[model samples]
Target chain A: MSEFKQADHKLLVIPGPIEFSDPVLLANATPGTAHTSPAFIPVFGESLKLLRKVLESTEESGSQPILIAGSGTLGWDAVGVNLVQRGDEVVVLNTGYFGDSFAECLEIYGAKVNQVKAEVGDIPSDDAIIKALSSKPKVITITHVDTSTGVLSPAAHIASLVKKHSPDTLIVLDAVCSVASEEIKFDEWGLDVVISATQKGLGVPPGLSVVLASKRAVEVSEKLTPQGYYISWKKWIPIMKNYEAGKPSYFATPPVQLVYALNTSLKSITSKPISERVEAHKAASKYVKDELSAIGLDFVPKNRDIAANGMTAVRFPQGLKAPDVLPKLAERDIVVAAGLHKAIVTEYFRIGHMGVTAVDRQRGDLEKVINGIKEVLGKNKD
Target chain B: MSEFKQADHKLLVIPGPIEFSDPVLLANATPGTAHTSPAFIPVFGESLKLLRKVLESTEESGSQPILIAGSGTLGWDAVGVNLVQRGDEVVVLNTGYFGDSFAECLEIYGAKVNQVKAEVGDIPSDDAIIKALSSKPKVITITHVDTSTGVLSPAAHIASLVKKHSPDTLIVLDAVCSVASEEIKFDEWGLDVVISATQKGLGVPPGLSVVLASKRAVEVSEKLTPQGYYISWKKWIPIMKNYEAGKPSYFATPPVQLVYALNTSLKSITSKPISERVEAHKAASKYVKDELSAIGLDFVPKNRDIAANGMTAVRFPQGLKAPDVLPKLAERDIVVAAGLHKAIVTEYFRIGHMGVTAVDRQRGDLEKVINGIKEVLGKNKD
Candidate 1:
């Protein structure tokens, strides 16, 4: 914690690799330790349990969590390789960039996908989704919070619809941007697979892809011969179980230092009421939207209610763009990402309000971001 | 650099997750940095360039290198998903556990595998490999230092033989344990693929899987409709190319902190003569093997000539086993791995002398390991 929370550099607010707590960063600096050492085994085992709590669940659902050394994209691959097999029909409730990428990944694994695409910053409507489910797809993937447009979809509502209409279909939610900062009830929502990365709301450095799967999902995975080796649930379920049971079994070497950092972040996230964390993110998000809205700015999402709690995507002012604004903010030591929605990439920018930047208000990170944007947008000239 | 070094802890001398350098470890603790920020872009780009040098390659061969946020096992899946499509015939030059594991991974991708297995502590005979190749396998895979047995297969020799017999077959080498410590001339050897991990000879913590591929292999990959998504070369090739040219292109978010650590480690490795580093490993390995043999112990390799330079797998003393000797060594603050071969897991142990532990004789890490083993093996009885 000795001056390592953030180095002598600008703030990172690009939605991922977010501002981390000092304790979490220090944990990343752990010395070289044996992956299977007695000291490390329990730490790993406990971290898996903590992941369940952060996901807002207990082990009673017969669900399991995984920590793999890869980015969030690997989670899409995991869902595709382990579940679809060849010629399986699936439906993608497309929201933004991540949804499109997931469709591409699933197609590579021989899944015949029917995409329900929404306009920018909008989620697929229930009417469209219900119509698509008529095909009796084997899986339905929804991006909980698409980083490309800061579009937060209603995951629980969709899962319930899926359950009522097609109970056999697995629900795969891409929650890369909405794990700790947003609400997720892995069991109560009847979610089957939740795929996320550590760089976002988890408040840890990137390197790990955290995936949670339900009992039925695992049973379905066990029956298929996965088309991938590293992406297979069959190879990893046993290892995840063994580690969670205080023993060491490895299908592949886990990332030791990254896992240490994840353990620290998970402990901090789960020790407090997760609902409080969600409230904090909501407050931070509202602050940014309110301040920007007063400046005559518009958001990518259809309305404030549909915007992601962890981030906001706002259109640039007339006669201004990212090239004109980002550098000015960087001059003030504030960093925000340019819009990533392929169609509107040059039209808007995104500000992330997840992790410590959202919860640890004492740091005034959101205030700095707001102040930086005001100065850059020429709103302070009056 | 500000006192982020290892604390009072035992030395890690396992086959991998070896003792990392202070600079590399400090880099791993880097504070939050945006993955696509100007500050991080060059670091990521330069790391890729340095990786090619470490693998002893030039772009002249139309070869490319990759660094993904995963363990070494992902490399196997990368090759399987990219090169050998389902139903492709491939031959595995089985040396030990790694060979069998690679075979299993390929088969999962629907490859038809013919494994030419070797006896314990040995590699597949050239005659056996030639016989297997006569059927015109699409790929010939070799484990360039099977960690399970410390048997270092002759990669160049095998590649040459494969080319002579099957002119169209691609040559793949798993160099997870041999990358920096062993000599691998990608261009000179006419090899198609060499897969490795960061934790072993690279002196970085475990997380990334580094792979180098030739033009011929890439061409084969370009023609295939890969079976998986995240591991596909088609998705990564352009991103790797863009980053190398100082342009930002996102495929999946890379592991930011791990890539920073790799950049530091790569700079240190590429700034000096790589041959001297290989020589250092050779000397350190000879010292370990000689001392153990003088004490009446044997290695898992058939002889000293075939053993891996980065590590040594030694049979336990006549009157002792891992339970007797490993704990004593641990008490002395030295950590070594027990045997992992399926048939002889209880008969031996492994000591790693790669990277800084092998190169920086000033550190005296190898001396500590030798002294600890001598003290524990009852060598002071006289």
Candidate 2:
């Protein structure tokens, strides 16, 4: 299955732009193919089908997956411009940087966005979400895992609460960091929309933004005229449906090479059980957390249950900053991300354990990260 | 410099997503690099410097180039949301499909758009543009080369006229199909914005929307707080400034691998003089156009001067259609695009001869396309 070997480089343990698998990286180097060709049609069609599988949904489930030539952040603009009409109220559950950005994006479309912020390492409580819903919002957005803090919200739990309290309100989850690694029961949890990207947990290189929405969300999108030509569902839905039907269509030129890469990555991901993939991420997260614990490093997230399985955000010990640790880690050929929270930008670091870095244990990327962190902290400890 | 070898596949002669070179394709398979790493910061900073070189502008000219993770279409939104305010009056020089799309994008941001359209395969006359400018628009958009009909507008001439008529109006050029292959004197022509993408004359892949704006345009953007977070220049300018200054700053996670590919392509392009590259493309375009003339295939563009050097949009012979010609070309392992102008979508086809297909004559991609077209047309001609 692994026909290509990845180029040798530093172990990328950053939150994303993660270590791409050999197949995924090589697929991106595919020869130029027409967006409308018969060869490219099946690749895109099969990719759409596999996206449903990765999200644990089926044709009968009335869900649609959208793949666009953009980053995870553009998915926010797509959701904002399409679903939330001007002057609509949206409750943003701000766990970290992504939540704040989403709320900002929604407001750009003239929506009144009220954010329910959590403590530095925690997600908003269920009571706070319920309280926010009493205002009768048009939509409620949640970040499944905030990349900045490595905090995984209880999405299924909050989704249940929205269904009960705000039956008409939509529930959108920014799963940019959580999609392939976390369990997202779309239909079971009554999710209205899920926003993600290929780079994070899908094992694909960074580019395409992936969005999935339920039947209700689709129904809502069909009725509203969005503000921008590029972000309008009125424009993209037909193109996506045409591609899924094994025909060529265009609202704008699709990124043909990235689609090939996504297809290869999706095939590799679906070739194994989805349950196995999540378990693999879980196990690796545990190993990294245990390793960090053994090194006397405390995590940003208050508890392990709330920590994201795809990545870990750990605080630097006293007297050491991002430079002392990050540069030293780079010297050891391991790369990680610095803190992103606006309040404590330089206090912590993030290490990703998603995709091939976690599943392909034979690659030993996790071991390299552990050793690199150990060596750095050992020398720099106060 | 050509150390890598690309795989053999069908020659792509579509308008964009043209055939990639050995080094360009290999640069895409790069291992994961952190967006903020010291190793990556210089690559991005240098790319910014080279972007100015290709545009024939100097750093002292107060022109800034934007690199974002999206398609060429997103470049329209970037200009729309950042430069044009709501309820602003704008004039769009309509040449083909892209003209209509950019007008629509501007309208989405609440601009009152006036379009001056020419007949199919032709661009608007200065008389028509000046007549439309009587409305005193806040901005005027011109497509440098509309991919739909392969019609290259006289952008510099129009900008000069607009300056004489409405000096306050911003001049935005959609250069998605023209950028590197065509001459754009940003500083000398007093152009405001040029919107482009990587997959075109820049010779990178299809992600990364590249937008360049003048200092005057920057002043206008700063004076207004636009809607939308993702496309906000207020948010992006600082991030771009940071990247160019060799600091790791983030508005969003860029497509790291694609940027690596772009860095390589830009190095290859700027290694030689811009005049040399444009001359090569013009020479190749003249060859292809002359060869098409010998076969009695007429182009959609009305005149040679108005025709784009990057691609040729040719009307099929009387007895042939897209199915008859395109598939036959594909059977010969050559691929081209069908007509994109809505009125004549089935009557013509496009052949791209930009980037490697235009410059790297040793690759024989242009020869393959010419021979394949000749074979297909020779068999199907009435």
Which candidate number would show the highest TM-score if scored against the true structure?
A: 1
True-structure RMSD, every candidate: 1.4, 2.3
Per-residue CA lDDT of model 1 for A73-115, tens digit only, reads: 9999999878988799999999998888999989988899999
Instruction: Supply fnat for every model shown.
Output: 0.83, 0.70
> Which pairs of residues clash in candidate 1, taking residues 3 or more apart in a chain or in different chains?
none
For B298-321, candidate 2 gives per-residue lDDT tens digits of 999999999999999999999788
Give candidate 1 misplaced runs (Cα > 4 Å). A1-8, B1-8
In candidate 1, position A165 carries an lDDT of: 88
Reference-based TM-score, model 2:
0.97
Position A275, candidate 2: lDDT: 91
Off by over 4 Å in 2: A1-8, A379-382, B1-8, B379-382
How would you encode candidate 2's per-residue C-alpha lDDT over A22-94 as one tens digit per residue?
7777778876677887878888989988998998887798888888888899889988888988899999999
What value does the lDDT take at residue A30 in candidate 1? 79
Q: Judged by lDDT against the true structure, how good is candidate 2?
A: 0.87
